[model samples]
Target chain A: MTRRSGTAVLVAWLTLVWVGLWGSVTAANVLGGLAVALVLVRVLRPSPAGAPAVVSPPALLRFVLRFLVDLVVSSLQVARLAVGRRVELRSGIVSVQVPGASDTLLTVLADAITLTPGTLTVEVDASTATLYVHALDVGEGPEGVQRLRASLREQARAVVRAMGTAEARSHPTPLGRTGDRRREGQP
Target chain B: MRDVLSAVLMLTGVALALVAALGLVRFPDVFSRMHAATKPSTLGLLLITVGAAVRMREGGDAVALLLVAAFQFVTGPVAAHMIGRAAYRSGAGAQAGLVVDELADVSAPPA
Candidate 1:
């Protein structure tokens, strides 16, 4: 994006946030917001912006709906296991690559995934764009790793659709899937 | 009916918080405890704010409540990631009941 547009977008976002925080959209609020936003943007001179995400409202809504469902389901699962008498779990950290994720997309994906129970990020390998996820429970065996890895990639795809660059949105396949048993047509 | 719905949501949220506390005490390790701390607690906060918002039925205040939820959603995961990463690199998970660890073979990401 051009310098002018980037500055405009940043100022607009900051102003919107300022208004939203104040819980009013009066003329005073808008003017104050604009003043603060302009000052912050011009004075602070935030880090240069990266590849702009092509946001799709419908896809964002869908991703949020799915994440909420995941939140509830995973929370309940953890709650049940927590309440059980003798806790037995097969926790493990698996390194999985997210296909087509840039720094921004990867951060969003990690945040969304970590917000849900059952899985959290142990570490991040930004060079390879990999996430080391520590799962609370991974069921029985290696298939568990497969399942979790696939789930992570699936969420990345959803994130890409919601707010990612066009190239990332197109390249949704995890490159390591070439030999995996997961079929192309499987649900 | 609105009151009833709000009560139910609030109660459920509190119950989830209780579950989180219970998990924190019962879970075996730091990572597991963090799992307990992160998810249910955030969900609990969400449900409570949503219930309160529903109860209020005001347009402006609901926006503020939504903002609280948004900030929590954004920051909670980041805090958990930092702690989890630290715990892992410190070898805190060497005996944390791992069935497999792929990261063991590969070096952790550059600090």
Candidate 2:
């Protein structure tokens, strides 16, 4: 195994072991960590890469700060919804085309959406680089869909940027007449 | 004050868990029920775990509690993703509110 791949495997293994050790000081826990680490290392068997280990501490810090901000904001938003009076929430699902984003960025965005209240990631299509998010409290009519799309676009951008990726310049995926199915006359 | 805080967290966690269970039982659809169950349950579990960790005077138990929290942090999203994907593919999410899924390209039958 090349050194780069070996290091990647080592990092994953070490993280698992650390998690195990950090969980409990008991002998059993320590042993468990060792066991888990061994299994993880074998399973991942990461391939080595030629790219130098780029240490971007600033990027890492930014990522952490972004995550914390999302956590607090989403928590408060969800709490308010959970407690406040019902206001006839206009919920809808919109798929945003996210172009030029890596797999890692996509996963992070999906996770962030799921963690946040009033939103869930229903699906991601890597082929077209689009993500479908189910949103709660979208306002009524065409305006609402536009707003919902914008909000998801903004949040998804934040997630990708936090992971140190460049802004996605992808075009919006075309949806047929079924895209905006809601109408003023529809029941 | 600490004891009071612990009691509150414990009660809140239990309440959330019960609400989640209720949602799972009463909700007509899987997606909505999953929405109800995942978020509150995760928050409740985290808060309760933290409370317990704080109450633990010993180092070992505290470490264990931290570990549990970390595990939840990693696994919660994974489990949610798995369930959501399963539901979407199984045609259970057809009734979901407001979606523009273009995954038809990816879902094409394997060549």
Candidate 3:
């Protein structure tokens, strides 16, 4: 594994440990969370070989800030959905094609998608660099799919840049094709 | 106060578990079923563990509770992801609903 990936794994493990022991020692949790956050900030160090060759720190900051805002907003939306009637919630799967060759980029994309409230990553085909997301609410026809793809593409691009792998940009894979419906027992 | 908290946590945990089971049975798709089972179930287990820790009449039980809670939290997401991936791989998902799936690019290998 590359040094960056190794760093990622270590950071992830530490995050897990902190959460696991959070309530046990109050001071430890706070210090551990901060310490882990700092390590992540440092370890996500960018490499020039990353696709696009331009890793923008400001872009990453913007993406993270936006993600946090979206998280809060989506949480409220989910709560409203839970208390109110079903409304127009259309839960369905959508696929996305990412442009990076590295596993780190793909994993980051999946985790980012899952972190959002309205969407959850159902499956990811790393071999093909494709992602499948289950959305809680979708608009009419292809609009929802288009929006999902747009959001994923934007986020994936930002994450790849943050990870410092700008050279891995490949072709934009078609989101999901319409009329590719699968019925059970149609193997 | 400790007794009251323990009782509340136990009741909440049990109630959440029952709801998760009901959701698992009632959901239309396997992905939804897994979601029902994993998320709420993990939360339920966490609550139960915390309650046990709080009500720990002995040190052994506290250690066991912490261990079990840690185990469940770590494995729950992995298990859910595996089940969802399996379901999607099996071509059992509903199409033409919303969102695009790119898995169509990789042809399904013959079983």
Q: Give the alpha carbon lDDT tens digit for every residue of B4-71 in model 1.
A: 98898889999999989999999998988988888888998898888887877667787788778778
lDDT of candidate 3 vs native?
0.60
1 versus 2: better DockQ goes to: 1
Off by over 4 Å in 2: A1-43, A47-89, A166-187, B1-5, B22-28, B97-111
Candidate whose TM-score is highest: 1
Q: Write the per-residue lDDT of candidate 3 for residues B1-111, one digit (tens) a residue.
A: 998998898887776677667666655555555555655566677778888888988655575678788778556655666766766666655432334444543544123
Tens-digit lDDT track for model 2 on A71-141?
Answer: 55555555555555544555555666656665656677787777776677777766655676666556777
Native contacts retained, all candidates in order: 0.75, 0.24, 0.21
The runs of at least 3 residues in candidate 3 whose Cα sits more than 4 Å from the true structure, single-residue gaps closed, are A1-89, A97-118, A127-129, A149-187, B57-63, B94-100, B107-111
Native A-B contact fraction in model 3: 0.21
Model 1, DockQ value? 0.71
Which candidate gets the maximum lDDT versus the true structure? 1
TM-score of chain A of 2: 0.63
Write the number of the candidate with greater DockQ, choosing between 1 and 3.
Answer: 1
Candidate 3 A-chain TM-score: 0.62
Q: Candidate 1 chain B, which ten residues in sequence have the lowest lDDT sum?
A: B102-111
- Model 1 in CAPRI terms: which quality? medium
Task: State interface RMSD in Å for all models.
Answer: 1.3, 3.4, 5.5
Instruction: Give Cα distance to truth, residue B14, candidate 1, Å.
Output: 0.7
Which pairs, if any, clash in model 2? A5-A48, A23-B63, A23-B64, A93-B98
Say which prediction, candidate 2 or candidate 3, comes out ahead on TM-score: 2
